[model samples]
Target chain A: AQRVTQPEKLLSVFKGAPVELKCNYSYSGSPELFWYVQYSRQRLQLLLRHISRESIKGFTADLNKGETSFHLKKPFAQEEDSAMYYCALRDPYSGAGSYQLTFGKGTKLSVIP
Target chain B: DTAVSQTPKYLVTQMGNDKSIKCEQNLGHDTMYWYKQDSKKFLKIMFSYNNKELIINETVPNRFSPKSPDKAHLNLHINSLELGDSAVYFCASSQETENTEAFFGQGTRLTVV
Candidate 1:
């Protein structure tokens, strides 16, 4: 079974400091990876996808096939960056002829000003 | 207009009662999905429909039924709701293919007393 793992239950960082939220996955084949974020009292939103290779809100995630990871990173954390982050892995279910996203438990990020 | 929307954002019901959550997507996507977020913030896919066809059904119990009347609507109905069924349910839509990004709706927070 494909699974996404976010080892950090909570990460506290100072504002303007670098931030990295770890994410790893277990899959048999190439996976489509994504980072979803949820701010307090807000709905979940898509942060970025590996295939897009586009950074959103100054955050970037690089897919490392060798490490089976797609960690989200930012040069300087901002107060707005404090939120719950979820890593997801999409697998193609040939039997169903569709794709399914498996999400991690999520990590809460706190940026102190 | 919201791209994806779920009715009754907050639902509080008693155990053993039946409840339903409706979802609609105006994105014109060919696929829709139902996901459950437990109290621990762990997300898991419950059901998926592609072009009105049941594409992926995870290990969800039979008590849960998903109905996709059209390509733009997917609703979830739960029978004999249990205390363990209290969680936020999210509806999402995406292009019915690989490497596609999903658009999530504001989740419906279900509280089973």
Candidate 2:
């Protein structure tokens, strides 16, 4: 079984404040983790992946294997950072039974000015 | 031009009706997927196809069927739709390897009246 858990339904923070959205997963096999963001009136897009270890739009997420977590963080929240963020994990194998993804319920981040 | 596109940006229908949503990707990717976002904004993978072959079906109901005529297109058809089926449906695609950040199309908002 594979699952992703996002404990926070909503996270509101003032501009310039740091923000963190927590995610946890349970997968039997090696996993590929991703963070996706959907802004107002915009299509859902990939923010970053754990494999890439890259930061985009001032946001970064660290995958903590010990804690079984992949929490997204930003040092300074901007008004434009408001969006729905989803954490997902894909089975690494390409075979018929293992190529799909399991996604978290998602957290809505509101950056208040 | 849009890299990925899904037809019927909005659909309103009564329960028990049948309908289909078409998706196409112009990115020449070998993998395509259909995802359902519920009212609470949880996105779940319903189906995945690789190179026109069914690769993943995430315990979706038999009423929901996905067809892939080619590597670039995947369509979903639902039978005996229920009010529970009302949600936002998204189409996505990605390359098989290197560049695996999936690209999503503008979602189709389906409302069961």
Index of the highest-TM-score prediction = 1
Which residue pairs does candidate 1 place in steric collision? none
Q: Is the docking of candidate 1 incorrect, acceptable, medium or high quality?
A: medium
Stretches > 4 Å off in candidate 2: A94-98, B56-58
lDDT of 1 by residue, B22-53 (tens): 99999998888899999998899888888636
Deviation in angstroms for A96 in model 2? 4.7
Q: Where's the lowest-lDDT run of ten residues in candidate 1 chain A?
A: A91-100
Which candidate number has the best lDDT? 1
lDDT value for model 2: 0.88
DockQ of 1: 0.64
lDDT per residue (tens digit) for residues A1-113 in model 2: 77999999999999999999999999866679999999987899999999888889998998888888999999999999999999988877656433556789999999899
Q: Can you write out model 1's per-residue Cα lDDT over A41-105, one digit (the tens) per residue?
A: 88888899999999899999999999999999999999999999999988865545256688999
Residue B8 displacement in candidate 2 (angstroms):
0.7
